[model samples]
Target: MELPTALYLPGDDGGFTATPLTIGPWDVTLQHAGPPAALLLREAERVSGIEGGQTVRLAYDICGPVPVGPVRVRGSVVRPGRRVELVETVLEVGERPLMRLSAWRMRTRADDPAAAVARDAEPHPAPLEPAGSRPEVPAFFTTDVAYHRALEWRFAEGSFNAPGPATAWTRTRSELVAGEPMTPLQHLLVMTDAASGISAALDWNTATFANVDLGVALHRPPRGEWLGMAARTVLGGTGAAQCFAVLFDEAGPIGRSSQSLFVEPRAQA
Candidate 1:
């Protein structure tokens, strides 16, 4: 199938149409959490009364599977403030809510050399570029899925097929929304949810790990198009798991992201 030009296209009645690029590896009909999470933050940033603030924290809760179709996006300033504010955005298919994002936007002073601290906090320098493009997608993904195709992946440490922790760099080929350029935050959010899939601790052929929520905290905004993540997944005995990643740009460590995952055995075909 020919991929859409963008992940989402604006529609009438304050809605957006999710394109094939939003489809995930788990289901062809359902949209991936990454695109929708970015959409939520995109809409939250556009909420009235919150101009000039930068989102420092983003908490996205996946209420249900977001379908690849028309979706209503609504945003509001739940807790308005002069320096700090809470913005909420919800994506709904008809009356059913698919996801909600609560973002904390804050005002920041101009960069000051004297005010700078923790400049050498985590000395995780960006890894050397991968030798070549990843040759194959995870076995669980169909060859026709557009989401994986929409983003370019280059692994610095482990690969899609390799188990255990992996560090990879990723950037989207398509725009987040048609005609409008995606912001740095949008680019980061669009690839954040894949931390679990790339750094799987369990065998994909045997177990499935789906994240229920994603939380991200950033001390500074990301720069450039490519974002890197050094991620790992930790599974508990009780079928609960968490994926954590130290987010990075070419400069260095920018933030961290964590995902709460629900793990179970993959059903036999």
Candidate 2:
């Protein structure tokens, strides 16, 4: 099968058309949360009047399944300040909103002494090299899924079939939008939503653990195309589940990501 060129194609009227590259393993007609989350962040950063600022926190709420078609993006700065600001972005399919993202942008401190303190305090070692890692796709994913084909994955720790924590390095082969290079932040956002799937604690064929919300906090900007995630999922007896991952770059740890899941048994086929 021929792969899509990019996850989205831009329109003249400032809208975007989702490509097959955005398809998730769960549904072919709907988009994976990764692409839409990244798209929301892309628009969030474009809101004017936020100068010399960087997004430190992102909270994305998935309202519903995002359809694979035209989408309208809207962004605004809700709470503005010189040193800090709050921005919000929403993705809509026609008149229905599918996803919303709220971000906190803070002023950059180039010479902050806290940098040194954090460097010394949090000394997370790098994971195994992607080149030498195993390139294995889980049985849960069909070979025809575009999201799996669009990303290169190298497992450094647990396998996808293993019912526990896993560490893997991942990167997208396609750009976020046609003709536009994806930013580092965009790249990170695109992969953050997969934390639960990678670190699933239950069998994919038996259970459905879909994340309703994703939260990310970044201490520093990610560098390089390859991103690593050391992730795990926790399921509670009360029908609540959550996934956590420490975001990494080639250099080292950059941030943390989390997802709140809505767990249920898979429908009998």
Candidate 3:
């Protein structure tokens, strides 16, 4: 058999929705790399035709299996208005509904004063290394990129061998999703939610549990694409664990993300 690759989904052709990228427990298919939370928003932005960096608020009522391959995504403004638009995006495999994403966005004013808030706890990002020295197949990600050609990934502090609270970076190998100026919120959607498996490795065994859910709230829109995330574990054990994180780039702190994990014992040797 051939090796797996870090694959990217096609935007215009419904990236990985063309087939069953992966289907496993607490495991996301390769076609769907990031969590459903923020991805739902980003996908909604494109399939639904919302402008980039728009001040958008979106929510998900994830019910059925989020299938992959030749998937069709359709979206529109629910409560269309001059200042803001309520948009929705749906994922389909042929004629079946796999997932639904909804969003709310608004136009803002210039020269607005920034709000006062406590700073993010993550420190300055560590140096980034070359991404070519590791295994090509995705690690821990349920969706094996056996067929897709996605992006390359570089870990800032941790790899599969390194310990907890590491930072990593990824981008399209062939620019499937790029060129559009992204906000910190959008970056958070991709990088911040990748804490579960890595967190478990840093604190305990190699793969102790998987994430139940992850949530992120942006105080302001993102300023650049060089996204950074500092992930650390705050709690664990007894079938539950929590991870805290700080996200940013050269400018300053962007926002934060929290991940909850459901624990299972290490497989008997």
The TM-scores of all predictions, comma-separated, are 0.93, 0.93, 0.62
In order, candidate lDDTs are: 0.84, 0.86, 0.50
Runs off by more than 4 Å, candidate 2: 111-121
Model 2: per-residue Cα lDDT over 91-174, one tens digit each:
999899999999999988675777757765775534587787789776676547566666788899987777898888887788
lDDT of 3 by residue, 21-124 (tens): 22333434423434334445656665443344364344444445554434455776677766767777665666776666566676655634334223344444
How high is the lDDT of residue 263 in model 3? Answer: 67
Model 3's lDDT to the true fold?
Answer: 0.50
Residue 85 deviation, candidate 3, in Å?
4.3
State the TM-score for model 2.
0.93
Off by over 4 Å in 1: 114-117, 120-122, 129-136
Q: Deviation in angstroms for 145 in model 2?
A: 4.0
Displacement of residue 5 (Cα, Å) in model 3 is 11
Ranking by lDDT: 2, 1, 3
